[model samples]
Target: MLPRSGDVLHVTRAASVQFLRPITFRVIRVLDWPTYDGWLWLDGYELNASGDAVSRRSIFVQREGLHQVQTAPQHRPHTVRTARRPVARTPVRVG
Candidate 1:
């Protein structure tokens, strides 16, 4: 889902991935810079256990990595999925 200002997202912290945990956050702004290999920056505040504000910070995440916790069907642990980059090739000379 496309994220916008005031949208809440469920982000998986790098340190907590080993434990499969996620933290809730509210999006304050979306950066306008071009995407770098599918990663972008998002500025927002981290929500506490009671859904309260903690502190504001900028987070880097992939476009597809950010999940809409507000409209998600279900909440669960984050699963890591890796895709292989396709090899680029020019026209091959036939014998």
Candidate 2:
């Protein structure tokens, strides 16, 4: 984590976090140790309810301290059209 601070941290990871308790103080503070890292925290009901986020590789992970250059759009069109829809009659979990 140290290398990314000033190229001090070599690796950065984005992971899910759950906080069980509520702090009564109106103001809040979050401190990090020597590691050069960041957070992607979700609080309770707001966490998994959104279909946009799932259990696996759910979030877009990117490297910090690096700028992302926009890429040109691809010239090819999508192989499938908008009318395509998957059959929804599949079985659900029995559990």
Candidate 3:
């Protein structure tokens, strides 16, 4: 699949020999540079286990070997609570 901006991928040795160690990558954009058939050059970031970007990089891999990561559904919005005001009391007159 053609990776687009914001796509998360699981890159491994299957993608390319350079990636002996697997990495979680977030795509910044797909590079348009020419490459051999079935191969592509991708511009993106290396993501940590927590899904945070650790570094920026460009990778070369086979399109058939690239795996897209499925992102979790968005969280529900929190409900707003209305606060109640305290009742006011009248002061007593002094003699």
lDDT leader: 3
Q: lDDT-based ranking, best first? A: 3, 1, 2
lDDT string, candidate 3, 1-95, tens digits: 88888889999999999989999998888899999999989998999999888999999999989889954345579999899798898998999
Q: How far in Å is the alpha carbon of 16 misplaced in model 1? A: 11
For model 3, give the 10-residue run with minimal summed lDDT.
Answer: 67-76
| Cα-based TM-score, every candidate | 0.60, 0.15, 0.72
TM-score of 3: 0.72
Query: For model 1, which pairs clash?
Result: none
Q: lDDT by residue for model 2 over 1-95, one digit each (tens)?
A: 11121111111222212213211111011223233345321111111323222222112212342131222234577577578687779778996
Model 1 misplaced stretches (Cα beyond 4 Å): 13-21, 71-95
Kindly list the per-residue Cα lDDT of model 1 for residues 1-95, writing each as its tens digit: 56777888888754233215777878888887676776767888889888898999787776676778664234478989899899998998999
* Weakest 10 consecutive residues of candidate 1 by summed lDDT: 13-22
Q: What is the C-alpha RMSD of each candidate to the true structure, in Å?
A: 17.4, 16.7, 8.1
- lDDT values for all models: 0.74, 0.24, 0.89
Query: How many backbone clashes does every candidate have?
Result: 0, 7, 0
Q: List the candidate 3 regions with Cα displacement exceeding 4 Å.
A: 71-95
Clashing pairs in 3: none
- Superior candidate under lDDT, 1 versus 2: 1
